[model samples]
Target: MTQTGASRNGLPVEVHHNALLQLLTNSLILSHTTPYLSCYDVLNLAATSRAFRYLVYHTPQVFRHVQLSNVKAAQFSIDGIDRGGETWRNVQVDENLTEDDFYSGPLRGIFSSLRRQNILQDVQILSLDGLSVTAELVHDILVDPSFSVRILSIRDVKNMNERKLRAALQYACRESRPEGTPRLRGLYVFGPKEPAPELLLKPPPPVPVRKAAIPAPPVAKAWNTRSKKALKVALVEAPEPWYARRGDQFPPRISSEWAFTLMACHGIIAFDTVLCTGPRHLNSPAWGTVNIDALNAADVPHYGVATHSLGGCASCGCAPEGWTVWGEDNLATSREPNERRTSGSAISEVGRFPLLAPPPVHSSNIKAAMCPTGQPVNPRSCFPSSTTGKREKACFIPRCFNCLRDRYCNGCHRWWCETCYTGPWATSPGGHGGASNTGADLLLGVWNELP
Candidate 1:
């Protein structure tokens, strides 16, 4: 075991505390219980003692995914969590607080206070909406090695107009990324929250045509007309499988929520580079690199753009470097959406949504995700099947190993369906695992403002 001493954040130094308790909390959170614990439960524990305070705040895992909006002390007071009474009351109120106020002061908001106290010292998935953000702040935060923010949301930020938004994205381009860049995967930006009192909320104002990378969205047509035309097109192309067709117009099917593929070596596989078009956004037609992955999934030219070409090869366990042996999803079958649904295939259990950042996923954390419920999963283990999957230590992919609906691996470019990665492999590959559309679930970052 590691020496029981100081945390990575360098806090509560030389203070006597219970090492056993800290270890227990860390063990339970990582392996057994789940990703999130109730805030009320965590804060109540923090209020109990100083040793517990350091344990809770400095542990880093507790705040793996958090939201700290600028709310007055009174709001928190009503939540029933004891925040040391005087601390909340004494704190000052400020709405337009940016990254500048990360210190102990009257004007500092909760976001800054979290930074000042090193509360976010090890945070991963972070949403900093409502704060007035700047372009330089976003650039510095993403580039900073100290912070491990993967996916960030800066919705409703004040003055985050088209110009500032463009500048923020330009900073994140692979060309501009300096050495020691974190595994920053995706960035989502929606329009302001709580803007109008009476009017309905709206999506983000469209990015200027000059700034956008993709072509303009198609004009809307009558739904009846479009659906009938779409069906005809799918029927004509139904003879060929998705994976079999060469990407004459665009890359294989990909989600707008998921941008480029994050190669195992950490280099991004930009879709626009190899193909004429990129993945369509789930909502709008706007395409973005280092900024947005969004589009409408249903439409001509955009048909089948929202999903991946599944069932290529076994991706979960260790197979040969090249997946020459086809897995179950690769068998010859009808390609029609309706007929394809009936065929036996390895359906990956829905896990974490692609839009969000994954939790602290070391090899140790993966065991929990692999075995979602208390019961053992289908493939049993991600260890190679030929071997007994028995060893003192297990080797798994470090980065890019996630609960992505498509169990895609960048190293081999394969799809590891739920049947392959879980409890035990049946005699027949990809046919049996008992994994359905639901059931298994996860047991499952940062930046600044501009001036």
Candidate 2:
């Protein structure tokens, strides 16, 4: 064995070198093969080997992203394991506080260490509702030139509103270098709705509608009757899926509360079918590139209008001369009284009814002509399958084909369902990964398995 280091510190040279080599090999393998493995898993592996400990100390990049919740302060330590090579040391001591309190502990130290060593490039923090660090704290780490964070997910921040959240995003976006464009690419803000008292104090603005040139038609007597009948039929046919087991239980199906919260915070509305709708508020020129479901046949003639509009297309910027007519038609057709009643009743029972209002006008702009009341045209069709070459299916679930519910198309790298497994969106021959619906199918299976 070649001995090189000054024998001052009590570490054996052979042990140190062995540890270093093991760490380098592990890091290299992990970096390439299992990039998405959690930080906890990586740390656990490091705890098994002295070389791993030294490697972890030198290479902070291994801890690029960390998700810590309600852990004891003692559970955290500068070194993952103790010097004795046996026990794990506890760095902090907080016994009374819950899991959430521990994670929000002035994470300045972790941030500083990562910055100094250049380890953290992406991070996600999950916490309890109503628990969030100040925007100032977030800004300090995210804006620091030394670190590069590409994705940030914060869960359970109840007090954060669109405006404050937007401000924080703007600051982070601004700090990124133009050439590099180091953005917080994927941001997922989640939490329960603020209390009723807070909502009552500041109710959301009413959804706006542009005046139509033609007089509004009288409420259709047939529609009202059909709607009520449909509701009764629906209730009889399928009662609400039991949320929990016979005993106590959290709702098994994703609730509107979760869906709407994600929608309002991230500007993405997720439906039961796994379709994700774009933010209805993002109508300004800056947000024109976002594409969503068409509001109605009258709003946009084609599926690309919303995408073109959001993407800053010159054609969409100029409001078409007769656009309002289309908008009006879409707004009228998009309204499903039966669906509305069901949603309204559900909301009212939870005491969150006041928040429900007419869907925003912007949403109407993307309303596809394929809805039940849609014009006699095809709405955005679902992905085509290999067997059904040209035909497209309708996504009955809340999610769209492009949403996470389906497998990502290898050819186009876009989300697509089984029906859309062929064509240009099909798995490319020499692509990174072939199109596989395993993940999505597993999730669906899990949902089905739920009691």
**Cα lDDT of all candidates, in order?**
0.36, 0.33
What TM-score would candidate 2 get against the native?
0.33
Off by over 4 Å in 1: 1-26, 30-44, 70-111, 129-136, 155-158, 190-451
What is the overall TM-score of model 1 with all chains considered together?
0.36
lDDT of 2 at 393: 18
**Model 2 bad stretches (over 4 Å):** 1-50, 57-61, 74-105, 121-131, 158-163, 172-179, 191-451
Please state the error at residue 145 of candidate 1 in Å: 3.6
> Among these predicted structures, which one has the highest TM-score?
1
Model 1: per-residue lDDT, tens digit, 1-451?
2345665555443443555356646755533332344345666777888877777776666766554334332122324223333343344334433333222222234445567768655666555556555555565566665556664556656434445444545455556567656344444443223333223323336546664566535554366557766775565442121223211212243333232221121132111111112223221112322121111123423212223223333323322111111111221122222122233334222111112122223321222222322223333334444665532221111111122233443433444433333323233323334332221231100011111
